[model samples]
Target: MVFDFTISKQGNYAIISMNGNLIEKGQAIALLEKAEELTKEGCSQWIIDLEKLIYMNSSGLNTLIQLLTKARVAGGEAVLFNMNKKINELILITKLHTLFKVAGSKSEAVEILGL
Candidate 1:
C-alpha cells in the first residue's frame, strides 16, 4: 500500500504518524525529509508513530537514522513508537535500536521527552 504521513502535536512534542510502506526512493523519504526540515528549524522532540506501518526497507531505516542525527545535532531528540516486531528486528540487526530511543506507546515516548 502507498504511504501517508500525518504530523500533529501531542502536547509540546511533535508526532509523525506513518501508514503503509517505507522503502528506498519512496514517499517515505519525503515524509522523513519534512520531519528533518522541522528538526533543523529547532523542533526538538519527536514521536515517530509507526502503528500503521507494514513495511520498512533499509533505506527507510537510513532515513530514520539521518533524521535522528539531524535532530540530535540540532539539540533535539527523536523517539520511535509502535514499531512492529519485524521493523524492530531490522533496527536491532542494524544496531540502531541502541542509537534511538524506542517506546511501546506514544504516551510512553511523549513522557520520555518530558512533555
Candidate 2:
C-alpha cells in the first residue's frame, strides 16, 4: 500500500490530505519533508486530514509527532482530523492524545486554527 498525500494552501494554513498506508520509512521521510517544506513556506497553521488513511505503523505515528513538534517550535499549530479508530487508539495508548490537537472534521480544525 503506497502512501499518498495532497497539499493545498488555504489562507495562512497548509492542508494535507493523506491516504493509503503510511508504514514505509520512505513514506515517513516524504511526509516529514513535505511538512518541513510547508513550514519553510511560512505555513504555520496546518490541517492533516487522515480520513483516507488505512493503516499506520509506529513510524507513521512518529512522523506526525515530528510534524507537530515542528509546528510548535515555530509557534504554530497542527490539527489532525478524521482519524480512524486504530490511529486514535494508538494515540490514546501512547498518551499522546494530550500532545495533539484533534478535531472531528476539517471545518472544525480550520475553526480551531482560527482560519
Candidate 3:
C-alpha cells in the first residue's frame, strides 16, 4: 500500500493518522510538510496516531524526530499513540523511545503531554 496521512484537530492537538509503509524520503517529507503546516497554523501540541502504520524505516524515525523538535521549538509537545509492536521495537532499539512520550490511547497521550 502507498503511504498516506490524515490530520485532524482535537482541542489544542493536531492528530496525525498515518498509514502504509513509511520507508521513502518522499513520504517522510510529506509528513514533515504537514507538521510544518500545522505549526504555522498555531498548533504545537501533536498526537501521531500510528495504529494503521504497517512499516517504518530510518527515514520515518528521522521524520518523527523532526516533528518532536519542531513542536519543542514552538513551545509545545508531541506524543504518539497506539504504535504497533514492531514500530515500538524500532524506537526502543534506536533509543528514541526515551525521547518520545508514548501512550496507549489518545486521551492517555494528551494527559502525558498535559495538553
Best by TM-score: 3
Give, for candidate 3, the lowest lDDT window spanning 10 residues.
25-34
Total backbone clashes of model 3?
0
Give the Cα RMSD of candidate 2: 1.1
Candidate 3: list runs displaced more than 4 Å: none
Q: What TM-score does structure 2 among the candidates reach?
A: 0.93
User: Candidate 1's residue-wise lDDT over 5-94, tens digit each?
Assistant: 888866556888888887866666677678777876668688888889889897778778877887788787999989888988888899
Which stretch of 10 consecutive residues in model 1 shows the poorest summed lDDT? 24-33
Could you report the Cα RMSD, in angstroms, for every candidate shown?
1.7, 1.1, 1.0
Better of 1 and 2 by TM-score: 2
lDDT of each: 0.82, 0.87, 0.89
**Model 2 residue 62 distance off true place after TM-score fit, in angstroms:** 0.3
lDDT accuracy of residue 100 in candidate 3: 93
Expressed as tens digits, the lDDT of each residue in 17-113 for candidate 2 is 8899988677877778888888888887999899999889888888888989988888799999999999888888988889899999989999999
* N/CA/C clash count, model 2: 0
Clashing pairs in 1: none
* Residues 2-29, model 3: lDDT tens digits: 8899999887788989999888887777
Q: Model 3 reaches what TM-score against the true structure?
A: 0.94
